[model samples]
Target: MVPGFGQNKKAVELYKKAVDALGNRQMPQALDLFHQAVERDTGYTEAYVKLGQVYEFMRQPDQAFQIYQRAIGQQPDNPVTSLAYQSVSAYLLKKGNYQSAIPYIERYQQRFTPNSLQWKKVDRLLQTARFGAQAVQNPLAVRPQPLAATVQAFPSQYFPVLTADEQTLVYTVLKPEGDEDLMVSTQKGETWSPPVSISPQINTVNNEGTPTLSADGRTLVFTACQGRTGYGSCDLYISHKTGDTWSDPKNLGPTINTRSWESQPALSADGRRLYFVSDRNGGVGRRDIWCSELGDDGEWKTPYNLKSINTPFDEASPFIHANGLSLFFASEGHMGMGGYDLFVADSTSSGWSNPQNLGYPINTSDDQAALFVSANGARAYYSQEQSASDGKQRSKLYVFELPEPLRQKVRPVSYLKGMVADARTKKPLNATIELIDLATNKLVTRVQSDPQTGQYTAVLPTGGEYALYVVGPGYLFKSLSFDFTKKHEGEGLTMSVPLEPIKPTEGGAPAKETLNNIFFETGRYDLADKSRTELDRLVKFLEVNPDVKIEVSGHTDNQGGVANNLDLSKKRAQAVVDYLAKAGVAPARIKSAGYGETRPVAPNTSEENRKLNRRIEWKIL
Candidate 1:
């Protein structure tokens, strides 16, 4: 039924006059008529709605909001409630009056059929209001400060990223000429050195921005548009850092990039997994986040949309932290205060958890993008517009101490930075490095030492034992173990690795080195489950050199009686031999020995030295 259908003829006539006055652009006359019409018949819904519309036309949203509320209150079951609910909710939400918007949003949700498209839209709005109210009530403890003037040299800078050690910073600079380029800076003691062009090969006359760096800072993946060979409007390009120079850029290829749009790349610490944004078909949103993995053949596989983290709205600027579990991105769909709030989601055993808005004041009514978190979970960097010293607005990088509440949600990480060199020559060697989680027998990360300098850095999330393997052509692969399952302090560990060549010895003795990663339970000869990763590496080594015969020796730290130690060591060596034989290695090509207590690599004094004493060693026979 038409609102006020036979109830108030005089009010209806006044509303008609008010509508005519509004058509004539007589604002004062229309307001006076609307007020008289609503006053003449308090329950006339049409008169009230017309009054509110006139108030809205006059740019008085507060008055219009009050008028709409009165119309709904006076006629709760009137058919006009739908329009009133939508109008009031929109104004309240736009004004960030989320607390006031909630009740109207609930009523708005009721007007549509359940599960209909309209209902889903309203449902999302309700969630946004609820989340916004809660966020306003409890803001994250953060105060973002602008980066050093040296680093923010340009009028516009954004998309900041850092190396695993937090020593190197990279970001996109919107130059005064309007072309974007990647800029880089190195951290001095307390301040950053002035930023310069990242590389001539990576930056071009075209646009090159939204760069992501591998934890080691050796691999860079970024977005480039125009003036380049591309598969889309903008496509991802990759470059490698060897010694101190960056290699020429290459497109990521069509398997990951499409004729549509693909940009904003985020690389895993190892550079094996890539996450980015795309507007291609098969996405849940107009622009969705997608991921691809580097195959064993070193090719990126077909990209799959990150459906769990993406919504029916755009998601951009994904940052896979050094720990590789926490994912930070910008989104317009998720429940938030307003436009493009920053959100974080964690990859769990099952899948990615629901994204949580980073919350106010880390988020606000304005859009937030390109958030970078430190490996230790201590700092976060993002881009925001601020008035410069010249009193003109510019986009600059701001950093803040990550809150303790959020810090607990992510794993703290450290890194191993070092050089891979030849043992005999003490010269740099290009080698592939892998870090494997011993507990799960899964590769934690993989990286490559720079071909020229042999420099490498591997990220290690705390609370796990790891097997580190270094492999290069014509070199005997090296293995080492790190036990970080217990609480440990420090930003990272550093060491130099010297790998021996896989050649016959000069003949003082057979070539030998301790296998630091092999594991055996105390007082037992059975191989623990965690030993499989190391054993598998050994098996592969033997397979590659099928003609070589080898001896596996076990040692003890002299803590036990000589007889018991000898027996234990011998059984352990035999166990390894048995595993190799079972794995298809010829029994005749292997020998087992027990050098218990007699062949200690280090004196059996401190626990650390004693640990070195009890180990498995392999020698070419």
Candidate 2:
């Protein structure tokens, strides 16, 4: 038996009684007997440690920590006090009291054995302590208020998604038997209607969580588990809302959802890219965020892992704001208050930036995840567990205003919505609408018109000019441009398109059309690699009209001397002629000319018109 003190007979007797009470699981009695033993002998190390053990059992961490502190003071070099440093630092660090835990960890390091395996963990805990101390000193005032009873009722509610107009709310509610279903409510001013189940096509006996909606609110994507045809235990599924009814849900296929686990779909504003959580394999973390972009061919490309924002620990629940630059997610990998702290990361052309913790009050020792922010970055919504009147714990959704410093990076965005119809019949037609950034000639997004209604909408992120192409079978592809340069919040544009039917002699007219597809580098007439796509279209057009001859002309803005502009323009026209001749077009049927700055379609004062002035035109001869 370990002696309680050097030579106190009554203290020894009291230690024996305390040990009996502790063995019987009587924590309060054991605590009092141990306290009495320590009073009889102030240097009683055994009694002090036993008192701490009793306090720890009673869930009194502060008293337990004080017991260890007193033991260390009485016997500075004792092994019992040295080991107690681990528990004291743990309690302080877990509560985010980093400054108080710092000295306790340092004292532990001095007396702890170098070969002990716990030193490595102690080092990590110490670093987290230092980080938390600084982060909490200047915390944001985050006051989250529970949503109204109309939206949150019964078993549980979470994962709220708001539309671009902020008039609709879509979310998920957990039912018994571990199943989840999507629910929706409409906003009438500040009050929301009672939420109703979205659609029977999406609800099933299986589990579904983390529902995300497209910018137009026509497409719905979510997670499903234990799927019959899924490669993994869980998979992502999608549904299309047509006319007031939703189509049957379809799995995203092997390109996106693998055999491990996938959930939490976050669709981009443009509806061309998807950000989700997956833990299949070959990722930096156990459960990391991955992305899959829509291809021009109408198929999803292979998903890629987000390397910069993921770590060895688990990461999940990605919510991309309407600004498209800020990303928020839940992570156990990034060091924070404790279990699953919410983090935010800014995006760039190259990749994502390093993640930053959302700070103290917004994040706590308890699990804080499933966060969603509005497009304007003004408000955010999240879910938390609270005790119900029935004494059962239930999760509910809440909303709060975000600090301005956090919303500084929110990008103002504008969207273009329209429908596709036939010019001759004036009837809706199924078509593919593709958007290209004229500044970079890069494909921005590709959305398909609803087969029945021909209605389509896509986000035009930020204020820039974009080319929208509408293509369908047995019809000529119609190209148009929309300028959002002056667009801001509470602003949007609406326009309808009419496609021309491809008749036998329709394009054989002597009328001239600008070759808007051709692209050239600044101050150089050399064609770019992507310009091949446009030239190929011309090749097909010529093949259809074998007997027709055309004259190719080039024009430029009136910026340089006439002599220099004529030379440059002629070179550009001949480049098209050369390409046609190389592609087996008879040399006698093609002619090249340089119009220079003589044909001014639009004034060159503004940059948009200047871009319109620099172009190639073809006329039937």
Best by lDDT: 1
What global local distance difference test value does model 2 have? 0.79
Write one digit per residue (lDDT tens) for candidate 2, span 130-212. 77787788788788888888998659988888776666789889876667888898899888899988897888776777899
Checking candidate 1 for backbone clashes, the offending pairs are: none
lDDT of 1 at 467: 89
Per residue, candidate 1 scores C-alpha lDDT tens digits across 1-621 of 244567677777888888889889999999998888878888778778777888888899999999999988987667676778888998888878889899988988888899999999898888888888998899888988999999988889999999988899999999999899999999999989999999999988889999999998989999987999888899999998988899999899999888999899999988899999999999999999999999999899998889888998899899998889999999998888767889899999999999887888898766777799988888999899877789887998999999978888778898999999988878899999999988888888889998899999999878888889999887778898887889443278888999877674475345676787878878899898888898888889889988778899989988989999999989999999999999999999999999889988788889989888889888888
* 551: Cα error in model 2, Å: 11
Work out the TM-score per prediction.
0.84, 0.75
Against the true structure, candidate 1 reaches a TM-score of: 0.84
Badly placed stretches (over 4 Å) of model 1 are 1-95, 100-123, 387-393, 488-490, 504-510, 586-589
Clashing pairs in 2: 232-259
